[model samples]
Target chain A: MTGKAHCYKRDHINTDEIIPARYLNMDREADLAQHAMEDIDPEFVKKINQGDFIIAGEDFGCGSSREHAVWALRGAGVRAVIADTFARIFYRNCVNNGFLAIECPGISQQVDSGDELEIDIEKGIIKNRTKGDQYTFQPITGFAREVIGAGGLLNYIAGKVV
Target chain B: MGATITEKILAAHCGRTQVNPGELINAEIDVIMCHDVTTTPAIDMLTDRGLSRVAHPERVVVIPDHFVPNKDIKSAEMVAKIRRWAKEQGIDKFYELGRHGVCHALLPEQGYVRPGITIVCGDSHTCTHGALGAFSTGIGSTDLAATLATGKLWFKVPETILFRLNGKLGKGVYAKDVILEIIRQIGVDGALYKAMEFTGELIDELSVEARMTICNMAIEAGGKSGIINPDQKTINYVEAHTAEPFKIFKSDSDAEYCRIVEINVTDLEPLVAFPHLPSNGKPVWQVGEIPVDQAYIGSCTNGRIEDLRVAAEILKNRQVAKNTRMIVVPATTNIWKQANQEGLLDIFMAAGAAVSTPTCGACLGGHMGILAAGERCISSTNRNFIGRMGSPQSEVYLASPATVAASAVAGKIADPRNYM
Candidate 1:
């Protein structure tokens, strides 16, 4: 996957900032997309495009188990999220929702905002197109990768169950 | 090799004799908790997939406490939708508003949680069940939907980090302070993807309510779950609530741990987590006299009967400060009834504090006593993140119920030792 980076340089960017609690009442995915990252960056929606990536520091999605955080980001055409680490539940939600989340050590320092990057899930390499830098990260392995490859856990399970 | 409590429980649920850390296994879930906030999305996902009928309706427990009393019309409609779906599915454990309280608190009180079982809930505070020795953790709605369709989910056996707390707690130094100190020592992600098994004499001496409070905030440290081996106190508490059969498991004395953290509580004072992060903790004495506009005492974290008693003891005859508004909420309807029976509610009402019904009101900035812009609140609830209690510009200080009550009386962040 190749995309432009939308960098959020801080650590522990909790779900409350990714998508605030007030918008949780909206059941539709499209309605949630409009408010993605509104709390942390009001102009985030305007800056994002299809297949863009979110670069964050450690413990991304640290608060709340609301899947709206994933839904909103996915709805806003986010291809994947690259962070130093992610909260356990949020990491699982990303896999189940087929929203890819990559754990790259010192990723925030390597990629600048608007820097173009290419991610090869199978190769486990992230190449920075703007800075001409290359970094290697551990790709999603084992059953988790299979789930994401099938587009989601439900789809993966459906294939196995039938 | 001897297994930790969490490993044993997960192995048992997986129909295996033994399991190791990092091994993936499919485990049967003993209970599944779904709240109103996540139910609509889960149901929508299930419908979109053309799947009808939940796999095991009997194993699913539904509670509508997050936005109960419906903060707005949309929230009301969501609750009604949950009611209709739960009723149609014949999920007898579904507790409507006014019947149940926060799902995390209500589960243990209603005997739905027990030791040596694997449980999953759609809320992060599900780790609170680990206080009873259950292997519980939170999952998102998609995972909840998967669990609803099949009474099983995959789990990675997490490595254990033993936290050995020693010494005795001083006056006004509660379990909240101990956990906050631990979080302060280890940054927010210190125990990422690991089980935090609390041990030692101090933890054994803590009440089940205090244990729950400690386990409830384990997520704040990025733990998969916080657990304590089931003891007589746990068994007795579970037995008093229900006659359901349960298993008990304990980690071997010589079991290996990825890391062991030693914490001493003898000199620990009441601690408060400053704004923006739970990891940003300091002793109450060092926080100075920061004025507060509101003081809240409730949430699944510290809204139990014992917590209410602590608050009532501090607010007995004195009224809350004129500049401060105090909101006290009991965790469960049963807790509310017991507090009223014991006259704790009368003491709070007489102290000029507004006592609310059993709900997670204002804890997640849901409703009821939300702070306005630039306002500051001292809360007994977990998580003091920015915009957690209301406006983004508002601030919150996290403390114990006793500290919250004392601060309410002083209109500032005050130490509970003076009032005690």
Candidate 2:
């Protein structure tokens, strides 16, 4: 999978902002997808295309361990989220739901918006296709990587256990 | 080499002799949990992945606490999905509306948590269970799904920062105040992604309920989890609730802590976290005569029996402010029953306070007592983020139950000690 890493350098991107509690009533992916990031930036839904990424500062997804945050990101066409750090809950939610959330220390500073990039998660390297910059990250465990590789924990578990 | 309590527990559970912070380690999880607000999506994702049965049914817990009694059709449908999923999965433990309180409170009370065990849930407040000496923390839906399927989790163990409290809390001061004070000193990002191990004389003086209150808010400080070593109070609490003996573990005197924060509680007065931030705390008096449109005393943070007692005692022989509305909700049915049996409910009712059924109502601005535009309310719940309690224009002031109850009577924010 390849995409231009569309980076937004913001921190404390809580679950509430990812998918506001108001739209939690809607469960369908399409309906919920339209409201993604409506709380944080009203126009975020209109700003990006599929396969874009988000790079954030510290404590991303800091409040409310709601999985909707991951769902909203996945639904919004975000393929991966590279951040300096993530709230434990948010990080796990991403992998469980099949979205790629990578923790690369100082990743927020390595790139800016419009900086074309290729994230080879399996190789544990983020190739800045635009600047020809390559950064190595602490790869998730084989199991976690496999889970995300298979499109999330549920999908991974289905293949392995079911 | 000596290990912090967090490191030791992770090592013991994961079967490693020693583990270092920031190293990827996949540890076995004893319990995996999710609740209403998050569980429906989790179940959907789990099913979409084609899982038929949980790897360990008994180890997985699903509670529908957030929107119980169904405020709207959407919430009802979400809960309906969970109910059907629970039944089909043969899930033995499912708490319905009245049966559910907060997931954090219900887990320990039902003996699902024990010390030295590693627990993960889909709610940040899952750290509350760590008060039992377990390594409990919150995980996201993606992680919860993996845990449900494999019954294991990968983690880079976090380093710990120790917080030692000394001296006794002064009148009307409480664990909520202590936590707020700590957050004030450390700022919101103070312990980002770190564990907080609380030790010291003041902890010994606190009841287990009070300690749970302290640990419950540890997440607000940006810590992975906050825990106190199990002592007599902790043991007694476990004993009173469970027939099964739980293993107790304590931090070695020689354990290494990254940094230790020492706090003297003797001089503390009542504290309040103003709207939009948990750490925006100041002495109750420092807030000076702040008026309130409402007062609320409930939530996972400070909704226990003792919390109720404190509020009820202060409300007796008084009435809520003529212009202000006050709502008192028991955290659980058991706490509600105990208050009824002890006549605490009478005090609340006689004081012109509206007593509601146990729900997470208005804590996240999901239901009853939601503030109208430009309104302000003093609450015993955690979090005061903008629009957290209702409209973005509305404000929430976080305080202990005593302060909420006392303020309910005075029709403005007032210190509980003044009335006590």
Candidate 3:
């Protein structure tokens, strides 16, 4: 998959900023889409289209196990998120919600905001198309990959139980 | 090979004779909890997947504490739906509003959590149960649905970090200060995906409540869970509430740890985490006199009985600052009842503080004591992230209950030592 990077060059981006608490009462993903990342970047929704990526520094998606953070990002047409590292619960939430979350150390330093990037999920390679450089990352493997391949844990469990 | 406490617990629950770090296994869960905020979404996902029955309905506990007393009609409807679902599912463990407290505190108080078991919840602070030596961690709504459907979930055995705490705590220094200092030393993500096993002389000397306070905020430092080996204090506390049998596991003497760090709390003082991050910790003496508009003393982190007593002691016969508003929330109804019976609630009332029911109110900026733009608050809650308590322009300083109470009385970020 390929997308243009929307870089937020900061560390420890928490879920509260990804989707504020005031908007958490909603039940629909579409209702949460507009407010996604608005706390950190007010025009975040207007700056992106389908199949975009969020490139961030270390400790991305920290604080709170609110899955609404992932839902909001997915609904905003973000295909994947690339960060130096992710908070544990957020990484699991990303995989469980059928959204791609990649961790590439020193990735933020290599690519600029709006840089074109290509990712090969199966091969675990990230290509900065704009910089003409490639980096290898640890791919989601084993049961985690299987769960994500089935479009989240719900479908994986449905298949297993049935 | 020797195993850590977490490995021992996971192995026991998975029915495996042995396991190690990085080994993926599906372990049976002893309890699963969902609160008001996440229950609606979890129920929706479960029903959408065409699942009608929970694998072990009796093991599932639902508590409506997040938006209890129903903030509005929408919240009321959400609570109603969960109540209906619990009834339809015959989930007798469900605790409705006013019947229970916050999910994290209520679980342990009601004997739902035991040592050497695995617990999963939809809330992030599920690590609080690890204080009892359980392998507890938080999961998402989808994972909650899967566990509800199957009674088991996948887990990657995590490497362990041993925090060896030693020395006697100084006057006004608290478990909250120790934990905040740990977070300050090791940035927010220092222990990502790792189990934090707290051991040492100081931890053994602390009450179970204080241990719970320490473990509850392990998630703030990016730990998957925080644990302390169950000692006589834990046994005595659990025995009073539960007759059910439970195992007590310990790390092997030679067990390998990813890293071992020692923190000596002999001369530690009260600490306050600055705005926007828990890692931005500063000793109370170092932080200058900053004014505060509000002071809140409650959350899964520091809303236990001991926390209340500390606050009560500081506020006794002293009025809160006229310019500052203070709200105190017990972590559980049991704690509230005990505080009221002990006249602690009376002390707070006389001190011009508002005592509210047990909820995660205002901690997540949901309700009760939200701040206005450019306002500042001194809170005992865990996180002090930007906009966490209200407007992004507002600031939150996190400290122990004593520090919060003292700050309330002084109308600013005052040192708890002064009040002591």
Candidate 4:
């Protein structure tokens, strides 16, 4: 997947900032998309096109176990999130939701906003097209690879049960 | 390679002789906790997939917190859907309005949580159950739905980080202060993807309720769970609640630990975490006079009866400041009843504090006591993240319930020691 980067160089971009608690009451795709990242960046949704990626520092998606944050990002045309690290639950949420969360340590320092990123899922390599840089993330292996491969836990479980 | 308490519990659940950190295993769940916000989504996902069967109705407990009492039309519908699903599944442990409370508190109060069990919930604070020596952690909706259908979930055996806390706690220092100080010492994410095993003289001396407070915020330090080996206090507490059978798992003295931290608690003052992060904790004396508009006490973190008693001790004769409003929410209906019988409610209301039925609202900025822009609240609940309590411009300072009461009386952040 290829997308432009929305680089946020600070750490701890919590789920609350991604989607505030007030919007938690409404889970519709449109409603969540309408207010995604309103707490941190008011123009986040308007500024990104479909298939764009978010670049963040450490502890990205910290605080709150709300999966609505994932829905809000997906709804707002976020294709994936590349962070130095992620809060544990948020990382699993991405895997279970079939959303991409690439952990590229120090990736925040290497890229600027609006830079182009192309990810090769098979090789676990992220190429910075604009800067001609390459960073490697932990290749998804074992059961996790299969879960995402099967398009999330629900479908994976359905297949296993059947 | 001896196993820690967490490993012992997970190994038992997965039918293995032993398991190591970083290994993945599919473990059978002994308890599944469901609440309104996330359970509604899990239910919808299940129904959408034609997989609406509960693997074990008897093992699930449904509690509608977060937006309990229906904060709005949307929340009311979510609760209704959960009610319909619970009824259809024949899950008798569903605690409807008036009977419901925070899942972490209500589950233990009713004796669903016990030592040496694997527990899963859709809320982040499910780690709160680890206080009783259970291997509990939070999951997102997809995992919740899968667990609900199969009574099993996947887990990566987390490395254990041993925290040895020793020394006597001075007057006015509570478990909440201890956890806050620890979080400050270890920046957030210090223990990422690890099980925090707390032991030593201080943990042995603490009451079960106090221990719960200490274990509740393990996530703030990026721990998958926080646990203490079951002791006499744990056994007595469980025996008082129910006769259900439970196992006791203890870590071997030679267990492998990824890291170890030692904390000395002597003369430690009460603490308050400043805005933006739980790791931004400061000793109450070090914090300047920051005025607060709201003082809230409740959540899975510190909403137990003992927490209410601590706040009541400071608010017995004092009044909430003119500009500051106080809200006290007992974590469970049983706790609410116990507080009322003990006259804690009367003391709170007479002191101009509003008493609420159990709800996680306001703590997560859901409802009941949300703050306005430019407002600050001194809360006993965990996490002071940005926009956690209301408007993004609002600030939440996290402190002990006693400290919250004292601050409410002073109309700014104040030490609880002075009031005592």
Q: Give the per-residue lDDT digits (tens) of candidate 4, residues B1-420.
A: 688999999999999999999999999999999998888889988999999899999899999988988999999999998899999999988899989898888998999889999999998888888889999998888899999999999999999999999999998899999999988998888888899989999999999988888888998998899999999999999989889999999999899999999999997899999988998888898898799999999988899989999999999998999999999999999999999999999999999999999999999999999989999999999889889999999999999998999999999999999999
**RMSD in order of candidates:** 1.0, 3.0, 1.1, 1.0
What do the candidate models score in CA lDDT, each in turn? 0.91, 0.82, 0.90, 0.92
Q: Please write out the lDDT profile of model 2 over residues A40-106, one tens digit for every residue.
A: 6778878767988888887787778777777778888887888888876677677666677888989
| Residue runs of model 1 more than 4 Å from their true location after superposition | none
Tens-digit lDDT string for candidate 3 (B1-420): 799999998998889988989999889998989887777888888888898688898899998887777887887888899899989998988886667798888999999888898999988889999999899998888888889889998889999999999999999999999999999999889889999999999999999999999999999999999999999999999998899999999999999999999989998889999988999989898899799999999999999999999999999999999999999999899999999999999999999999999988899988899889999999999998878988878899999999999999999999999998
Best by DockQ: 4
Worst 10 residues of 1 chain B by lDDT: B44-53
Cα lDDT of model 2 by residue, B140-196, tens digit: 766776677778877778888999999999889999999999988986667877888
**Share of reference contacts found in each model:** 0.65, 0.65, 0.67, 0.77
Model 3 chain B, poorest ten-residue lDDT window? B94-103
On a 0 to 1 TM-score scale, where does candidate 3 land against the true structure? 0.98
Q: Give the 10-residue window scoring lowest on summed lDDT in candidate 4 chain A.
A: A22-31
Q: For model 1, how does the per-residue alpha-carbon lDDT over A15-122 read when each residue is reduced to its tens digit? A: 888888888778687899999988789999999999999999999999899999999998998999999888888999999988899999799888999999999888
- How do the residues A1-162 of candidate 3 rate in per-residue lDDT, one tens digit apiece? 899999997999999899888776775789888998987998999988899999999999988888989989989999999999899999998888878999998988888888998999989998889889999999888888988899998888888865
Instruction: Say which candidate scores most in lDDT.
Output: 4
Clashing pairs in 2: A92-B143, A93-B142, A96-B142, A97-B142, A98-A152
TM of chain B vs. native, candidate 1:
0.99
